[model samples]
Target chain A: MPPTSEPSTSDTAQPTDADALQAEVTRLRELVGPDEAAYTSLKIELWAARDSAFGAEMAAGELRGQVKVLEGQLAQANRNRRWMVERIKAPLRRVKAILR
Target chain B: MARYSILTPVYDPPEDVLRACLESVARQTFQDWEHCLVDDASTQPHVARVLEEYAAKDRRFKVKRRAANGGIIAASQDALELATGEFVCLLDHDDLLTKDALFEVDLIASTDPSLDYCYSDEDYLSPDGKFINPFHKPDWSPERFRSQMYTGHFSVARRDLVIEVGGFRTGYEGSQDYDLVLRVTEKARSVRHVAKILYHWRMMPESVAQNAEAKPWAYEAGRRAVQDHCDRTGRRATVVDGVVPGVYRVQREIEGEPLVSVVIPTRGSSARVWGVERCFIVEAVRSLVERARYTNIEIIVVMDAPAPAGVIEKLERLAGDRLKIVWYDKPFNFSEKVNLGAAHASGELMLVLNDDIEVETPDFIETMIGLIQEGDVAMVGAKLLFADGRLQHAGHLYNHDPFHAYFGYPANHLGESSVLACQRETSGVTAACALVKMSIWNEVGGLTPELAANFNDVDLSLKIRAKGYRILWTPYAVLYHFESMTRIPTVNLDELKVMRERWATPLKNDPYHNPNFEPLRDDWVLRSR
Candidate 1:
């Protein structure tokens, strides 16, 4: 009989210390697979979030432009509604003539 | 043996201004011209003296004094009779021609001998001799000409065409030149526009340039002349005075009540509009059915699959027989939905409308139909207003980029040159409420699906224009657009790149927009760059 736990000429077909270590490493990789996939997905979401923020900033800039235009239009409307000098002076001149 | 003959009808012009006018002609760089000046019995003594002096100095200045004071038309006819050149150029008594005016005209004429008519940009000369308000006119806008005499100054026409059009009519005294231009242009073989300020219009106290109300009869004459042009052109239209004095509106009569297919693409979205939460699609269909004056419209709603069933039922109840619902189970693409709705439509005309739109003008459909019926105009857009009654779109201006003319201006804001009050040709119009012929829509393959959300209408407009069809935008048709209420309109950078690549030339050079205008600006302000 050969030594039971020791390596012999036919020991290559048996599970040795190196083979067991390789099997343990394979099991650990299988355990971390789902978490690695989740991390990659989170990275992709981060990039999308950055893109959305940039889009929001651009939209905000356009809204600012719109606000400026609206303000200008308001000023123009006010000007249009204001009484002209000729119109005001005409009434004043008529009142002065009546007083005279 | 002169190449050009200038006609000037004098009537009590200030001596200094008249002399300056004559001197301006005399100082022309191109000397192959003769000035035919007719004095209509001026009460001022210096008028005759200045006329005689100009005539004596240069034989090109031929002066004639009338026995009695005939009006401007008669004086112009007399001056016309004295013309012995190939082309006759109209000049006012007080207005001065730029030094290179004749040279520019001759240069273009030399290139194109068949050029029957030519006009140029002009500016106003104040009483203090300061040049202000330069009119940088666009290239040969016949629709704009019908709205107003934009090509009033530096008008040059072939002598034979002028004579054939009967020179100037007696009845059109105040607006004789406008009448002549309309008649001449009707039969013109080719028309050219010189994009240079070749005339300085002297603004006297009584001049129409100084005060629009100074000549009230002129507006009436212009209206009549426009109506006459319409009648001659076999268009059943009426000309009416516009909101402004000089501009005229052509109210075209629609022939038959052609069925219009209103294609609206929506997600059955709702927003707090004017402090009321309302479903956009329901209100849009309701307004089309109930509020619009034109009732011969079929509403086709292309609703997304995720849309509420209640909105569909409401639209069905509201629109009754005029309603057609098409389910869109795909991703959101405005262009694709519009195409799908249009595919199911059975109408002569197709109106591409956004669901966030509400009909403001009762005759909005009728107005668009009338405009689309005009010459070669395949597309007509309504004046869209924001919810707060601010202008959203007047017309599209593609100056290196697409911009809405007078965007965010007040609803009543008469744009630079009363553009808002007039119906005219534009580079493009928004699809928010655009009416196009079904044939043209099919020809252009409808809105480009690649564009999806942004610039789809602009792409369609350019395609139609490329096929020699005109696109018109009228303030006559108005609607309120709750813009981007249903969706956030973020510009896709890819779509912009596609637009730049496809419509590079047209985007840079808009025929309706002047080159001197600022690029990327909605207002017609002069470019500082």
Candidate 2:
């Protein structure tokens, strides 16, 4: 019998070949069923976990991409700020001295 | 039949280095070996000359000159064709095998002829001619191997099995050996380990053996190798770049949402830890609720005295729907409290956490749960750190006195002067933060109620291990254990006696721990003979 198949409870305890085989199958099922159920659940959870991990990785990738783009923009702004500060400083000093 | 077919894929190694490697082979104690040296079209003419010389000098040394540079993997496959022996052993062109390396391997194989794979202990040889970083490895640990190829060299495998696993593939030059080891071991009936340091890995400036970062592509190849192993084995898992370079963090996903019974035993005592006044039970529960990303966890608080009146209301409020208070007013036995908690808990996996512990990682429960859910993994443990940022427990080592590995070691320290930082196999993990399969826990009769304070977890782990299951200590699953932080340490001399009497043999000598190492030390320092 298949490991996943449920036991046939309707079978009688008669001394027939099919009955004996079915009874043996039911006995084996009784032994392995609970463990099989737990294993099945564990497998299902594992798939979910993998999917979740993959999703997390994807989200992290997107965030990293965004951070990289932002970092570049920040660097450009810093460069522009430096240029403006240097260029405007002398003129501002000149204006301040005249005003004083 | 020739016992070993030593495959040495000679590339552009220096002349002196090549000579040393050849000399080491000639010095082997076990003589029945066919050394197949494949020259992978080195730019230097000396490389070919050295191989030709070696081949001419000894009939055991066979030469295979490649037409083009096929890299390490393809060259290894070509060398495999020339191999005519029972077993295949990989030896880097610049690396040296110890004198009795082959002898020890042959002895193990002769004893158990059906053993599919065997490896010996190895250490790196400094350029200044010093033997350093000796790796005293444990017996065949599949999980440890998956974490990182601790079994790096002196790998002796059944020749048929090597070819069956496709010898080796191209493009995995930097970590081709790791890839092959993974594949070959997957189908192996028995994998034995020789604990003696028998392989000398020479460290050169250019070799990946020297610095893993030298070939950054190697990490990606390693990741793929581990992934392929998981896929073939039908395990739901993924491998990612770890906190450090070269080491991999293998993340396994348990398929279903198996309910985790977060059983915490506490007396609800308040203590000022690092200038912050906190109740142990409240904070531990709060962290589990707020930090742990997983949803399927029931926080069962086994309290000694109904959480002092108003504290009970507050705890219930904090825990919300996930709290179940099991009152155990009996004279404080740590084991009984835990056993009572397990009885009350309605979950497949039992996660026993110390009341003083706070979750450091968001995925703490998930990581521990994933490990216990895996087949044949009886229990799971986490790396616990103290409040002052020192290691409280990083797994345990049984010796003359059972002690924690890296105990009192700096929390941020990466295993000072040894290889304790990697994920590894151990006899036991502390119940300070441990996860166990409830079924297995019951089968092992839970913790011995007699050991109320200490050694209960150790005894349980040893019993679980006896049932042919592994107890894993994961560095990935980390937590802050202000260990016995807000609780009293009731020294049970009788309980200690019970544990020592029961586990005298294992306590004296841990199979996972090497006898050569000093019994009382934290790191793998050699005990002077």
Candidate 3:
């Protein structure tokens, strides 16, 4: 509500280097704010991509373990083939013998 | 005038083959049947003589001759006119029926008095009379039937139903049986499958049993028959030739663009895929954003608390407004995370995907959306391939234990019945890349939390099936599943016990799989006997 005793700057003469330098700094700040934000966002995106690729690598390692388990199961199955065949064909052999 | 009438349209087959066919019918253990033979103006003189001898020998052998040369369809119609039995069994003139063929049919029909259609397994008979290549068929796969006529030989049907479908359409001469079966099943009250090899299709030089390509025109006829069936059944789909000759692909048309909620649960784990270290969730979202052809989808990522630093920022940057992040602070339970993500989704269809999956098919979402919209379908799963381009999951087989069908097979290898490439009903499909109807998901109570990781998808599948819903696996939608890359693949004893307790009967007897297949095997290999 009270009036100040300080004089207005617009009416003063303009020859100070500090004032020009300050004006230039204000202008540059306004111009570079969006570019800086964009650059930071792009960096985050790049990091995310790298993390995704790392996830895939981790997946490959896990796949190796799972594949090994499957190979073991397959080998066991092959080993039991003869036993299974004999067990399954016993009844058929009995029936054929009766018919003969 | 008989209990059963056997219809055989005779062409100029070899005299020995014709005599063998007649002898097989004459030696039937169930003797209350008549053989209706129609010679289609055979140019060879031996055909008539053989027919005359068979008719003279057995009073049950009814023979007729067409004055002009008519195709199989016309001959079959003439034979149909001569039938005066309650049921008709189709027999190729050169093929031989097992002695117990009619006996098995009679027994099955006696047990189920309301049976309208019946079929059995068959094999090819070599020139030296050795049986080989037995087609052990599933119980009653209606969807698989639409793909191909797996129930090819020894088809028995009620004579009234056969006559009602106008016998066989003239246009479908080569594939007349396929058309007839499709029409017959549409109105069938109960269809029974005799899981026995009752027919032996002779692999003659000109026979389809010798080589599928012997009659290429038959496949086109089959395609038209499928298309006509789709039209009659009010299915909005286009039938195209499948990877092989007799198989077909049904590309359904989506009614409207419905919103799809893709729920992915992850801990923001990192993996080395092709020597590149990357975040699994971020790459999964990136693939959806960059590769998918369908646009009406939202990405719901359920992330664990204390999330990896840059993963969330990257997902936001990639999916933008289409992304919704839900925090999971509890211990890692895949079922709970998926249920949490599903609870927050706002779409008609819920797509449960793993963090390591990369979309390979551009129209995978659209295809899944169309399939899940079917009235009887509860869920649909995608064909998954490993990082090395080997098959990871075609579907789940639960003959004894739950396992992936054709796991680690070549990516392009079609399974025993071309099942790996067709969209057909299955006992279960993996939740790694499955799209389910939102209402059906809620109805089945989602995945059972008790099954933290192992058998969760199998439990969900059984729950859905218990509600009389079908689970379909489609090869049309494909994805690269770098499985076990994030979470270690370990099975807990408690989870296995719970699954056994809940789904003991279905786990033991999977109707989608044939009994002749060896139990506890992923590949459809026959039993040792």
Please tell me which predicted candidate would have the highest lDDT against the true structure. Answer: 3
- Candidate 2 Cα errors over 4 Å, as ranges: A1-100, B416-421, B484-491
Query: Which candidate ranks first by DockQ, i.e. highest?
Result: 3
Tell me which of candidates 2 and 3 scores higher on TM-score: 3
Per candidate, the number of residue pairs that clash is 0, 10, 23
Candidate 3, residues B383-422, lDDT tens digits: the string is 9987766778898999899989887666677887788767
lDDT of each: 0.87, 0.81, 0.89
TM-score of candidate 2 to 2 decimals:
0.81
Cα deviation of B371, candidate 3, in Å: 1.8
Worst 10 residues of 1 chain A by lDDT: A76-85
> Whole-model lDDT for model 1 versus the true structure?
0.87
lDDT of 2: 0.81
lDDT of 3 by residue, A1-100 (tens): 8987796577567746687678876776676574757656766886788777656644654565457446645754674687688877989899999999
Error of 3 at B341 (Å): 1.4
**lDDT of model 2 at residue B227?**
89
Q: Specify the poorest-scoring 10-residue window by lDDT in model 2 chain B.
A: B412-421
lDDT (10s digit) by residue, model 1, range B1-529: 6899999999988888898899899999999999999999999999999999888888999999999999999999999999999999999999999999999998899999799999998999998879988888778778888998888899999999999989999887679999999999999998998888899999988889999999999989999999999999998999998889989989889989999999999999888665457799999988888899898889998989866867876887799889998999998888999999999999999999998988988988988898888768899988997776667889898988898887766677786777778888899999999999999899989999999889999999999999999998888888988885235569999999999999999999988878876677777766432
lDDT of candidate 1 at residue B161, scale 0 to 100: 90
Error of 3 at B297 (Å): 1.1
